[model samples]
Target: MAAPTSEPGTFAVTYRWGLPLDEAAIAAVSELTCHLLKGCSPGSSCGCKVNRNLTRLVRQGVEMEMPDPTLIYSEGRTGLPMADMWLAMVNPYRLTSPSRVYSPDFRRPRVQQWP
Candidate 1:
């Protein structure tokens, strides 16, 4: 959990994986998480504040994952239920889709040096 920012009552959740996950996979997961929290169907074309604010936030920093503001109060929608549901069955390893068997960018082994 991150410290509250200049935005009133706003905070961020940060994650650092030991293995650097693929950027595309991370993005898919992030968007799915956002939509789930906003009570919006995945891939829905809703012009809701949740989507708009999230897009802006992600654009600002792709390295950081941004929570859907609408789930809190940005869109006047309380997402407590959705949040609870998520927490009850959260799986960090869950993927939106199967990853490639091998990719130079995501699957390359890291070089290590012995002390």
Candidate 2:
């Protein structure tokens, strides 16, 4: 698959894996997520930072058919990452925003209260 065209420094370094993710994959992904979170701005929410980076990694992994352990971690935290990645990759220009959907700005009407 073609290398991601996004700007450099937007994502973390690529991780190489001998095979698809296993239990070890979980540990690796968590470690990488922590590392990525460390670099985010102090005011930035940890959950958001983790999710964004992980989502990018997973999307790349699925398309390439080689799951990077780091990206796999994102999937472990929230299964949606892998599925979201697949959808995003298929429709690169799609405007769908997970953040707005999952964690909406409270200023707006709280529609369909979440459990």
Candidate 3:
């Protein structure tokens, strides 16, 4: 799912992983989504810095096969620290405007849940 944005060059991308995910999987994918929001440019090759760095980070940081959905829930939460180590990595493009990362209500589809 994606939220509407008025910016011409910006976009919103949401990954709806059905519930039952452990905290670690949620964290990994959330981090991945944040990298995507930081601007994976169109026509980017596999060598795109965003792609390369995020992949490496996931591999080293998580060290697990990306898990499949394991449980179901009405609501959950996820945190993305835009000002933390994520920003320490190289992002050649600008941050996607109006970017937000959170756990959505799987039962309600695109409805976002608050902390």
Which one wins on TM-score? 3
**Top-scoring candidate (lDDT):** 1
| Candidate 2 residue pairs in backbone clash | none
TM-score rank, highest first?
3, 1, 2
TM-score of 1: 0.21
TM-score of each: 0.21, 0.20, 0.22
Q: Tens-digit lDDT track for model 2 on 14-114?
A: 77877676554555566656656765768665444443423233364564343445655554333335444554454566544543445455476668977
What's the lDDT for candidate 2? 0.51
* RMSD to the hidden true structure, all candidates: 21.6, 23.6, 19.4
Per-candidate total of colliding backbone pairs: 0, 0, 2
TM-score of 2: 0.20
Q: Please give, for residues 1-115, the per-residue lDDT of candidate 1 as tens digits.
A: 3555666688766788777656554655576577655656656554453345442334444556545665555433334454434433443454556566766687666999999
- Winner on lDDT between 2 and 3 is 2
What Cα-based lDDT does every candidate model obtain?
0.53, 0.51, 0.45
TM-score of 3: 0.22
Residues 1-115 of candidate 3: C-alpha lDDT, one tens digit per residue: 2434766666767787867866555666677676665557677553325222122234445763421222111112122344333433433343545567666654555878999
